[model samples]
Target: MAALRTKIIACPTVGEELRSLLPDGFVLEMLAYGLHNVPENLHAQLQASIDATGPEFGTILLGYGLCANAILGLNSRRFRLVIPRADDCITLFLGSRREYLRQLSLAPGTFFLTKGWIECGEDPYTEYCALRTRYGHEKAHKITRRYIQNYTRLALIDSGSYESEAYRKYARMVADYFDLTFEEIPGSNELLGKLLSGEWDKGFAVIPPGQVVARDLFYGPEGMP
Candidate 1:
């Protein structure tokens, strides 16, 4: 049999994490962040990337969660699309849906941060600053406040792979600036590792050839693939 041809098309956050773990011969493509605001455009771009991969890779592994159904109705005619059963990238970073759920239950009002998210400069503070710059201080302050009113805590996920004093300090500073309860949480690469290792379980939604990815796949087997 030929080698398992695989490509990981992921959000930049998880894509950067995978860069350190994936072995030789894997095609890795990291898409731009900030597309969360435009789901339709993001989905189109994602599908374009998938289709652009051509027939060289037999499998396309997505480094994303449900992500507001960004991948809903995506057609995977060229190769099978395997995605982790997650609501968002937080689940992938935390290692499992259960852990994410626990965090969710513990802190319903949370702003999750990671090294990637921090380095990307797309946090709420950044948005606030951009808004302040473009829309003036008063308007920016009003909108930014309303934008993040629901979040009371900021939890930084320290994956232990890319820990740096600089990022941690920024995280703390953001917490202070936002007046949020700051906490540090451990992150795991177990899920992403298994994803690159071709270890498919019920936690993964494997869309075979000839079938487009449905919204239900994001919910796992119980939700249907």
Candidate 2:
């Protein structure tokens, strides 16, 4: 028997709340590191955390495109990245709703708001690749290889073939990043059905790693807003 470990990341506001709802006996942490961009110190801290945690699985849950770049480059073998079925573009765009909407002129109805949240409109993998490119292809490839080595699996939850073009782009990116092994779990209607079918030992969901239940922790009266 092995211990289950997971990393649940969400909006800066919701990380604490999500941590509270997690099951006991599993090592859990929130991705709340603050820095404008990838910094050496932050990377070292991340390395230290990985070494200290020593969990068999690492799951990432937020969609702001902030940690994806860093997470893919971590030097660990038990890492897994999970994103909600909604397109990453929505998450990226909404990182700064006012600015994103003003620049892109995105209508609120884009992608029908998966799980009742805005989309960021970027491919997780492509963006990751871009980050790698910034560092240099060889370095990026090396880091990505390391990331894959540690990454047990990558999955996309709350996804379905019946999504908008934007969401489809997200699906494609997840596939490309993990070589298309991403699973499309229904977010609204048949979420439970999909979870019951999968056998993820150390699962991670963007909203609720391996679950299609997307809750708003950053907005509304109860949300952070």
Candidate 3:
């Protein structure tokens, strides 16, 4: 049988990483970063994008994780869907589920940041600034504190896809402002490289046409419903 024609539909949150390693000939479509704020909306947008994709493409690569179960129940009547087996994009940045789990174990209260996140202005710090503009500084500080009360650290994942000086400065400022420990973690593009190279292996979920994405695909036999 002939190889399938593949296209990638990804969240803009990982746009830089994807572009850095993307192979030739594959078209990449990046959705808006704001969709992640609402899982339901993200799910709806993904399903719509899949359903509306041209039939010329036989497979669609989703550059997303379970994403708060946003990808769950997504189905394509005309194409196969390929997704990374990750709880979130942070796993992709870290390069594997094991690494992501390890980081979680080390710092369960960490709030992770990446270049894309900083560039998109979606982090808590950005929200705090916006709130400070409308509300007073004291109120914004209280609100921001409430939002990150449980977070004890701010971890910036350095993927090396781009320079980190400016982003690092911003992350540190946010960390200092919130009185959280600041740390920079080395990131990898191994999993993303594999995804773009069709190295499905056990790290990816390759859903067949008409099949819905399920928790088990990402979490294995012991997956929770």
How big is the RMSD of model 2?
A: 17.3
Task: Give one digit per residue, the lDDT tens place, for model 2 in 1-225.
Answer: 775555543443223223334555444454443431454544455555655544555553333232333333444345544433322233332332233344234222222223222133233354457767589777776665555543333333333323455554566455555553443333322222222223322222323323332333222233321
lDDT of 2 at 139: 73
RMSD of each: 1.9, 17.3, 2.1
RMSD of 1: 1.9
Candidate 3 colliding pairs: none
For 27-145, candidate 1 gives per-residue lDDT tens digits of 89888887877988789889899888866689999998878888888877778889888888999999998898899899999899998998788678888889998899889878988
**Candidate order (TM-score):** 3, 1, 2
| Pairs clashing within candidate 1 | none
- Candidate number that wins on TM-score, 1 or 3: 3
What residue runs in model 2 are displaced by over 4 Å at the alpha carbon? 7-14, 31-33, 37-39, 55-68, 78-104, 107-225
Candidate 2 structure, TM-score to reference? 0.32
Model 3 residue runs over 4 Å out of place are 1-4, 222-225
Please, what are the lDDT tens digits per residue for candidate 3 over residues 1-225? 655577899988776799978877777989888898899999999999998888678889999988899999999988989898888899999998888889989999999999988989967889899999999899998999999999998999999988899999999999998999999999999989999998888788888988889877877774421
Top model by lDDT, which number? 3
Query: Distance from true position, residue 216, model 1, in Å?
Result: 2.6
**For all candidates, what are the clash counts?**
0, 15, 0
lDDT of 1: 0.85
